[model samples]
Target: MQYQLRVSGNLYKELQQHLFPGDGKEAVAVALCGRYERDGISILLVHELMLIPHKECYRAEDVVCWKTETILPFLEKASKKDMAILKIHSHPGGFPAFSDVDDESDKDLFSSVFGWCESDSVHGSAVMLPEGRIFGRVITPKLESFPFDKVSVAGDEIKVWEHNTSSYSPDDFAVRTAQAFGEGTYSKLRRLKVGVVGCSGTGSPTIEQLKRLGIGELVLIDPDEVEHKNLNRILNTTREDANLRRLKTEVLSSHIRETGLGTKVVAYPFNLYDSPEALQELITCDIIFGCVDSVDGRHLISQLTNFYLIPYFDQGVKLDADGKGGIDKVSGTVHFIQPGSSSLLSRGQYTRQILFDECLRRQDPVEYSKRLKAGYVHNADVDRPAVISINMQISSMAINEFLNRLHSFKNEPARNYAQVSMDYSDGSICNVAEDDLPVDDYQVMWAGRGDLSTFLRMIELSAVKV
Candidate 1:
């Protein structure tokens, strides 16, 4: 089910300045075991694993840990016994070398892995990165890493290989899972084609996380190039990129490649708003992520999500300049749009007035820019989006929404749309949600029929049918 997208076009250097943030690289296996039947749970992708290397003891900042109790929520709804075949997380900090703590952990963790792989013979191996430059391998039993030549991730796909078959170790599973990066977050990701509509701000983080999460194929779109003005945010882009005017999509595609993560990224240096192929290509993806600044973009994407039943996650952020200059307020929203769930447009989250106006102005970037500099009654302008904190907050919220949509969590959580505003005008060490704000057209979707939650419903319905 793994997929790949051949990259095309040259990326302008301006766009390269937006990937990776603050002191961090990756150091763990982003592995996935798929299409297996034993778990009875149709398909599952376990992420953010903490591997016990029998020689290391450590904690993780980026490990995607599943609340062991999270499994309980699924039991009442699904039929499969719990199964864990995949183990992946990065050496977020410290050397990629397994700590003594890792040793204590890997046995039981892999014990789970060993059991999960019962249907298969070879256990999965450990993927470790000693440094940003070298990707090391640690096979179970033998515990030695062969060197991989080059790691590439186009979008969601992850491929790890040494010289050839010689690097394929029978003792570990990373060899095979690494082959496809089988939807690193869900068993279905391998078969799913994803689209990233923008490559700056939230879009950059979205793609960065998607690469780490390991999806098989991705199509990237964005006509904008990196600008020094964007240095305040945008993941993975470097400052130097601004000087060179690199295309956002191309630069992001290269950064994804650097991870040695195997994903196929198809780059299109065009705005989805004007690109006919954009909608056509997105229609084919399992899910679509929207990160463009135009309300028109989100409205258009929402319409598409409603028609095709493709799951979509959209993020919006706003920040008010500080009275004296230090950003005073931040706000963000993360909304999940299920194709058949609800009419995002009908809800009035996006108005025909705004959509039409933006559409009309789409042909003229400069005129539209002037109007945005003038601001609107309820519109977010790309020129002055909510500062980084708000952007980061909603980015995390959106990523979590992706996770929630992927896994079958308990409670059949309702309300897939939420927006929060932050104002530290008073300056207190606390977090609060901004309510009663105008959400006149905030569309709500994902009425539980797009992903694992959808599957969870099926399981429950089937149980009732019995």
Candidate 2:
């Protein structure tokens, strides 16, 4: 099984501060983690962090020891919640690999942790360098350790570190892209597994760009089939696809395979709300691009990404045409959501009332229609105008947002552009920072609660186990 660890950028910053503290000695900390294990993939999502006080440990440049009792409370909590434990420490001297001393310390510490927790789950030990880059390993129940295959930090900028950096020789189609972003960034793209929700309009173009840019793997989720109306906006779709009523995911997956770029694709022809298996597949993605139009779909993806500590990019387009045939408004928005920080809900992308109404409309359409007629719910069924040019523009912006987060080529920091708004009618654009957005207490309460008994804490999902 491939083992991985994910930490929110906010928590990673906290760990860095406590671990470094401008000292020339090592320091220790403990992290309580929620886990997701399926299909030979195991991930640890850090839920909470506890820093051992410097005064409580004997510190040196290469070695630091703390009392085992300091972590008993956290261990008890982990046992109660079925969570895993991760022991993290700092290397003040910029050591790249785990030392022999670290191996000995981890063996002893995890042995006690496995015994105390009394569960058949894996634990981890990590080391952070002065530059805030982290690497770690997972320890099996037998106390045998294997290096983490991947370690990712979900923040304003998506940062990922892999145990092995596989060599890449770009094909003819990707040679130009490699030159534009540098070979290192291109190599990173080849290692990333991205998920795209929704396959029409924005999602099609988003998937096209990702595959051409050499994404290693893609998980495509959408329940709809190709209708004639989608031919105008969806890329690579033909009249035959529309007539055949082909699944959007299937069409996209086939196109990617035909490109011969070696980008693996897994298509799920099912709605995100009703499929627990799709949710499990989505969590395996390093980054998510949410191109769905429904408020409920966006809301669900926001919750799932936060739970798994994955960075998310959500984009939508709005076209308002005056009944007289004149264009009144044309606009689009792309929101970049970081785990443990401001979310789409907190950013006012949708209100709780709207989310509730949408969910009702999906679960009980007859009741929703009756409520709509009674003026108890908003009428959200109006068909909006869509143009390929507008969709492509917004899709490019969203993909560029993802690229900037990976390579950081923008003049301003990624954190400053939590939301990007493009007004095509006005010919203007705007960016909003994360600090400017409001926070929702409810979203905060659920952040990093991975693999809960109920998926996303939604009762309906509990019935369908992954």
Candidate 3:
């Protein structure tokens, strides 16, 4: 089976710091991870990482040898969760390949660790060059091995190293899109597997644009049914459908299939974070458009994008009311979250406190209600007014941003606008206010941080069994 390893930027940064401390000596890094299965391929997501002190090593300058005391504990911890283990060490000599010492080490280590833990879970070893490029491989208990097809690190910018494939030609249908962004852009769109979370105001419109642009496949996630009030903003929704309480995803799924555009659609009428089975489908997507409203929902997408090494575009709309029944503040934000770049958290779009409050509400309505009544916590707007026009405007901008990313059609660098915020009342849009990508040496923080050490507090109880 083919394998791919994803490391979160935080862990990657940790690895770099530990292995290349200014002291200038090789170090050891170990990560305990779980598997994401897609089409029989196992994608390892490193959840927790630890740096073993080099003093635990008993080798000379050019070689690395870890003490059994340090190695046994990591293996035992990994075996407890049936998780895979990745052993990594740096190569200051600029060799990306495993050295003879590494081969001898793995032959002895991989062979004994499994016996010690009685684990059939896959274990692998990797070599990281001084420049931070990683070449990883999966090893069998029998000592057989295969190189990892690619490695991904997710942070403010997503970095990927996939096996090469020939470029494709755009079809006749993409003529207009090709004219606008060059033919090369169309090829990128066709090979993409995009995910749209939430099929309401913003999500529906975002989906509408992606389909017409000749995207190859889509995964739609929404746990809502059409309501009478939603008809005004949700595209492709009808009166009859609203009256029947038809699932929003089903409505969109039917439309895409009817177009016969060869765009595959998988609709899940469930919250993305609450459905592990559905989350699996998302691992295959190249990009995700987060169009949900809740802070909790956004939090999940923000983390998922990093772990899966998938770029994400998250758009949100907010309206503030003036007690006097007049227009007050109308604003929305379109943030293009690339892996290995500055993240939403770093941007301050949503805070840890907001996520905490939202989770409390979802888990316990009574306590949340009591807290709200006592003014112990602030609540988000439950019935914010929404208009199709503004939704369309923001959605269009987000889609345009997506195009800009793949084609860089604009004269200025795309990074210039890491985030674009608009004030509808003021009729102004600008991306300069927000901080751009950070230059931290650890840009790879969660570049590929996959499944959490434990199911996220809110997601654990909610993940529906397949």
Ranked by TM-score, top first: 2, 3, 1
Which candidate number has the best lDDT? 2
**Model 1, range 19-123, lDDT digits (tens) per residue?**
112335432332322121221212222211232332232233433233333323222222243222333334545455455655544555555444333333222
In angstroms, what RMSD does candidate 2 have relative to the true structure?
1.2
Tens-place lDDT digits, model 3, residues 228-317 = 999999988899999999999999999999987778899999987667767777776778899989988887887667656677899999
Q: Where is model 3 poorest over a 10-residue stretch in terms of lDDT?
A: 433-442
**Cα RMSDs, all models:** 17.7, 1.2, 5.5
Q: Report the lDDT tens digits of candidate 2 across residue range 330-419.
A: 999999988888888878788989999999999999999999999999987888889999999999999999999888889999989999
lDDT minimum window of 10 residues, candidate 2: 439-448
lDDT of each: 0.48, 0.91, 0.76
Question: Compared to the true structure, candidate 1 yields what TM-score?
Answer: 0.49
- Model 1: worst 10 consecutive residues (lDDT sum): 6-15
TM-score of each: 0.49, 0.98, 0.74
